[model samples]
Target chain A: MSETRQINVSKSQVPKLAIIALGIIFAAGLFVVGFDQGHIFSLVYGEQAFTDMYLHELTHDMRHAAGFPCH
Target chain B: MKTSLFIIIVLLSGAFAGLIHGTVNFAIVEPYLDQAIGIENQNLFASGEEEDTTEFWVEYEGYRTWQKSGQILAGMILGISVGALFGIVFALSRNALPGNNDVKKSLILSGIMWLTLYIIPFLKYPANPPTVGDGETVVLRAILYLSFIAISGFGAVGFYQLSKKLKDNKKIIALVGYGVFISAVFIAMPENPDELTAPMDLVNEFRFMSVLGVTSFWASIGIILGLFWRKLSSQKETTHYN
Candidate 1:
């Protein structure tokens, strides 16, 4: 393909790529939410709910792996 | 055109994501098992002989309900309002010639706007010792307000920065910064049982989750609308360019 045509093709693909990335992020988020059901409850409540649920769950899992009583 | 549409798509997608994810576990997955287990009574600790329920349970339930409803409503309103406001601000800021330092101006303006709406309220009502139901009610209400403001403000900043950095290597930096701010708030949350003035009513949790779901859904809608507007404008520009 000519350089101009290559650029056009790549430009057209940006939106498609963004959509795919978003889908992956959303799926990962759901998985995190499902895994941390208990903490999800806590995070949903007023005090702690403002925090990103995904990060909290990941941190909790890490803590558990490192032998912390995250529960 | 692409940027606006991207914003809208992200907002809508995030909202639906929140709602579906929030409901799936409680409404379907867990409830099915609970039902299959043949649960005799959900609340096992309730004393059968009690004539008047204890004030703790009563206050807890009341505050819980209030928090849930307040959060949902706040989330929806905040998400849309903030999203639109951010989009307009972003569009206007970017309209300036490239390399003009107007991005900093826009960021500063947004920061001021956020501080005025989100932070001032907390400053007005600093976190106090847990009072009776009154304290719980007050704090929960404050939290809902703060959450809406913060989400909208931070989301906008993230969106704006993401737009600017779309072609730059710093896109991840912008996204991660917002992510860290949000995660820090969660981590810093005081988890002491005493700090929780409200009782842990399971029903209340469901209610709160529902509100969050709705908020996420609407915020996404706002983003979608904003994207549409941007797309239309961009198409006009493209036609002119052609």
Candidate 2:
């Protein structure tokens, strides 16, 4: 039987990969937290008033504070 | 200081500043909004035939609930996330800017960023409450606002690049030139007014508060981060810097 070995990766590539991951994560976070207007929540809830209201309640202050449209 | 460490500190500092700013906004603006612009219901009973028609009033459950804890939490989150993103960009652009401390440089950079990224676009299309404006016009309004932001951003970068040729007061000259250019664009762009649903004063107040909250957050982030970075730099030894 051949001995198993770990996959080799370039050391310099680690930081580059981490940076890309960070960017992607942060971009998604900003979109969800700031710019999302019930689009995500609506998927599961089917565009109900309660869904919008709940999301709005959670984000309304942040939206105005961060200079995003809330109304 | 290590760049990653510096980024973390800047993000935390921004969050702190944003917390304070958000607290103030929640305390003052929330109450004002609640009292001034709480509901917008049309009169069902009163007909146009009625000689003495009273104002229509309908209390709504509304979207947002005023909660102190929620506001504070949101504020801190806003500061950290948005600040971190901006902070990274600010750090990357540090070479192009001048300053002993990255944090202090951030102050000037953030100011320029705000001017171009937000204020310019905002001037053309002032922020409205969530309930304001016709629903159909949302797309057109968004396009217009985005275009304005893009113009301001590119114009600013162009000005900065051009200012490199000038030796004396480069920043001031670039700012003046950009301001003039933005002003011209502002004048040329036709006004796209939306139907006002809320009371004018209430709408204006909300707009003012929104601008104030954002401005305060940026100002605090700059100052707090600057102080923290300077303090860290003083404690550090002679380091390898590019």
Best by lDDT: 2
Overall lDDT per candidate, in order of appearance:
0.39, 0.64
Deviation of model 2 at B29, angstroms: 1.5
Interface CA RMSD, all predictions: 14.8, 12.5
lDDT of 1 by residue, B148-205 (tens): 4456466646655675757677667666666566555545554322233323343244
Candidate 2 off by > 4 Å: A1-26, A42-53, B41-63, B66-69, B95-103, B165-173, B187-193, B233-242
lDDT of 2 by residue, A1-71 (tens): 44544442212112343345446645655655455656767778876844555555666666654555444
Check candidate 2 and list the clashing pairs.
A70-B130, A71-B129, A71-B130, A71-B131
Please write out the lDDT profile of model 2 over residues B85-204, one tens digit for every residue.
Answer: 566556556667777666668788878778787787787878776456554665466567657877888898899888888887566898799989999988887665567766778778
**Model 1, residue B110: what's the lDDT?**
42
Candidate 1 CAPRI level = incorrect
